[model samples]
Target: MSIVDGNPNVDTTVFYNASNENNLLYPDKFHQWQTRNNFKSYRQIGRFSDNEIAEHLPVDKDKTVVLIGGPDKMGSHWIKALKQMGIERSQIYYEKFSW
Candidate 1:
């Protein structure tokens, strides 16, 4: 998963990938970029904390935002924050999956 802060002046991209044990792994190069760019990254087990939710919210409050992901509780937290920020529920889109 990745999140961009949406700052044209400060380009930042955080990447987290789940490994075999459901642990997140970050590439060395990515880590280097994060350190150099002062970007924040995380390795989450299942759910994300409110701080993490706050970090992902766009810095540009005027810009429209979209959250896309498979059905999961993590998305709910993001939806809550967006709603609290006055974004319409219709603006959020969840990708569908068929079991």
Candidate 2:
């Protein structure tokens, strides 16, 4: 997930189970992203970059992509960048979020 907050303590553990293999008494839930997912959380203090987006995407550009952006026309920026990167308008699905 992409969180633009500048808070250094914005940890992702809260979104997942804290219990690890050693803590057998409270094993992690199957749905925990930390335990079951493979992703890298980037702590960018400024604007997002194309390399950052491209690195995580599949080489096969044929697949459709989804973007969930925040308020203040946050979705607009990424949409334009994606288009410039050769992504088709029809291939993108976006949802602007306000929180």
Candidate 3:
């Protein structure tokens, strides 16, 4: 399983289940990327808290996590959470984007 950031600016942690498209902050963009990449499934999670973010991650030992956010608090917290969950540094990828 792979986790990506849906919207880093969101003040609260929001899980994008995809089952409920209306709850996703960037449904169109996320859908486009997912389709273009030809991924069978994807999971998006937006959060500012490390513990909260960690709770939503997959427990698999080999899960890959991709983070798309700034290099600030939001991104750092996610990285921290992933680390706490025992995901190796090599399994993580960070992409910073300017609004």
Candidate 4:
């Protein structure tokens, strides 16, 4: 597994692996980012075939919405839709060479 700090100012961490495991694991100090940032409320929309990713998305609308996957064409499609929905690219983190 590899860990990455998505942004310099943010303490949140993202984990990825070739086995198709990708996720943002919040540090204890950044737990507030999960709550205060409304990460608990956003509904997670994922590809029908990607039940694992969909299951991790926010169940409510107040949480930070997450779109997970590699940079494959499918993931790119989701990224585009997310952008259309006003989600900043910075908010969408992916692992290096995840595709």
Candidate 5:
């Protein structure tokens, strides 16, 4: 297994390396990127604090914030902190992995 760091700054996209594991990623089977199959040119959060995340969040209220991680308590804390920073529930998406 390998974690494909989408951005050097943030350790997001903790996906398994299908090629290395000889298995196919479920989403990639149906929807595939035309180019790099990953995001490009976005700054990394690098596991920054909730305050830092709030500070760096774009001013555009329409922007969506996605927080993904394993089923950990830290994710809940992050949500709470973001809410305290005035981030709306509609603007945040939290995805937790069981495995």
Candidate 6:
């Protein structure tokens, strides 16, 4: 399993903050998870470019992808990209930020 995490900074927070990610991620969480199925986490500090999205996400028929916590428009763009990669719509899930 692979995770692509994007935040304004290194911290994880429920609320908006410079270092919010620290609030959500425990120390060595990524490393610990990597023991099974080669769990990997890709952290995108600051802006998440389309290039990064294209790079991290690979085309896989058996992949289950969930797109969460981003702008609604960006989510749509991501869905489109996934479609172009031959990812089926039923295999994609998205939870867009309400705000």
Number of the top candidate by lDDT?
1
Cα deviation at 78, candidate 4, in Å, is 1.1
Q: TM-scores of all models? A: 0.46, 0.52, 0.46, 0.33, 0.45, 0.53
How far off is residue 32 in model 5, in Å? Answer: 15
lDDT of 1 by residue, 32-77 (tens): 5565455556554565555665666666755544645645655676
Q: lDDT of all the models against the reference?
A: 0.55, 0.49, 0.51, 0.44, 0.49, 0.52
Q: Write the per-residue lDDT of candidate 4 for residues 1-99, one digit (tens) a residue.
A: 112223434333232223222333333534444554322322222334344434544444244545465657656766776565555677775443342
Report lDDT (Cα) of residue 70, candidate 1: 42
Q: What residue pairs are clashing in model 6?
A: 11-19, 11-20, 11-21, 11-22, 12-20, 12-21, 12-22, 13-20
Q: Could you tell me which 10 consecutive residues in candidate 1 have the lowest summed lDDT?
A: 13-22
lDDT of 5 by residue, 10-89 (tens): 32332222223333344452233213444322223234556656665556646545554545575687777777777787
- Stretch of 10 with least lDDT, candidate 5: 11-20
Candidate 1 off by > 4 Å: 1-10, 13-22, 35-38, 55-59, 64-66, 87-93, 96-99
- Top candidate, metric TM-score: 6
Candidate 3 lDDT over 1-99, as tens digits, reads 123344333222223332344544665655654543324333544433456556656667475545445546555666766777888777766676434
lDDT of 6 at 82: 69
When summed lDDT is taken over every stretch of 10 residues in candidate 3, the lowest stretch is 9-18
The C-alpha RMSD in Å for every predicted model, in order, reads 5.1, 11.7, 9.1, 8.3, 9.3, 8.5
**lDDT measured at residue 98 in model 1 versus the true structure, 0 to 100:** 25
Model 4 error, position 74 (Å): 1.7
lDDT of 2: 0.49
